[model samples]
Target: MELELKKLSPEDGRDVYDLLQALPADENGFMNPANGLSYDQYRDWLRFAAACLEQVGVVDGKVPETIFWLYEDGRPIGMGKVRHLMTEALLEKGGNIGYAILPSARGRGLGKKFLALLASESKQLHAGRLLLTIQNHNQPSIRVALANGGRIERVTADRHYIWIDP
Candidate 1:
């Protein structure tokens, strides 16, 4: 159950997209709430991911501080991201961390392992706590968060925001 995390590359875009497409219907795909993404929605998501990379100035031999890929047994299974506080809106609403495990990879402890790995990495980035926002209905994510020392910070109308402090 050892999972490896690697920095994402543009070459990985296709595999990531494919994994997202094959995500199981019961678990959250790229756009949580499961039911998976429509063909048009998937295209739009790819466009948006590309735009975000461009906006971060991380294209062409640059490393992104936020977005990264999560791999298991050399296969792409999910993505994890941590946005710095440079953007005030992200600090407040989006929080500092977010992750999505492909539905096909769920129930294998990959998500929990990813969360723990990121929480440990947060210390190097001067982050005392890692923030996670899960849809209220995502029981699996909530369990994963709690298993990784996440404590409930607040429960909004539609989401539960938890904090995993080091």
Candidate 2:
């Protein structure tokens, strides 16, 4: 199984669109920003995402973010995002990284692998530590985070604040 982690590209095709569409708009605490977008709308969203990744500096208090896709043998299997910088809002709830494996790709240790790949990508962007905020009930995600060397930094009424080192 040849696996690769690739940055999001506006030029990404229908396969990418299909993958995003497979995820629900909200799952546990993870949000699928691309859900419900029409094909053309999805492409437009990609353009916006690409710009966010390429922006040199934070604008209007919004930090830059880069999304990545995990591919296995050239087929997309997972997707994630790394926020280049953290704001108080991010620290509180947004987090520095968020990810989701294709529902059909769950189990088989893919979530752990995906998280690790995102961390590597974060390191490349000079993003220090990664903060992951998982809903309290999402044990699968919590395990994935822990397997990747994440430590529980805090706990809220409904969330687990984990920090994964770069």
Candidate 3:
């Protein structure tokens, strides 16, 4: 299936909520919400996500972030977050990009394609290089990063820091 990456928008609230609902709780730490949320709450969250692109709201003491939805034939199948600017704290942990494919859409190389799309977007934003960190056991993500020209820069106890030039 052909896939495309689209920035999150207000009109995508319902689709975004559905995508979130379709994800497993432990799929990706940042993409997972601890509890179920009503549509209204999810809409509010979407608003915040959109505002993050402008660095208007502060969440967890980070910079503004841009979120993108991966779509296949107009259907949301995955989501990714790109931090426009990286702070010291983010450099150490969060990295510049984060993404997760829906549970039903895994094992088809979508993850690699998602990161490649994010890399292109990052380049357009003037990001010289992108930082991606994945859990040590997340072989799938690691492979995705590596396949997208990501090099292992460092390794912490539970995370692997990969860098890719966009």
Best candidate, lDDT: 2
Give every collision pair in model 3: none
- lDDT per residue for candidate 1 within 80-130, as digits (tens), equals 766443344443455667677876677888888888877776676565667
State which candidate has the highest TM-score: 2
lDDT of each: 0.65, 0.90, 0.81
C-alpha-based local distance difference test score of model 3: 0.81
What's the alpha carbon RMSD for model 2? 1.1
Q: Which pairs of residues collide in model 1?
A: none
Q: 2 or 3: which has the higher TM-score? A: 2
- Give, for candidate 2, the lowest lDDT window spanning 10 residues: 23-32
Model 3 C-alpha lDDT per residue in residues 7-99, reported as the tens digit of each score:
988677677788888776566455565127788877777777677677654557867778888998789988788887777887877789988
Q: How would you encode candidate 2's per-residue C-alpha lDDT over 49-104 as one tens digit per residue?
A: 89998887779988998899999899998888899899888888879999999999
Q: In terms of lDDT, which candidate is stronger, 2 or 3? A: 2
Which of the predicted structures, 1 or 2, would earn the higher lDDT when compared with the native? 2
- What's model 2's overall lDDT? 0.90
TM-score of each: 0.67, 0.96, 0.90
List where candidate 2 sits over 4 angstroms from the true fold: none
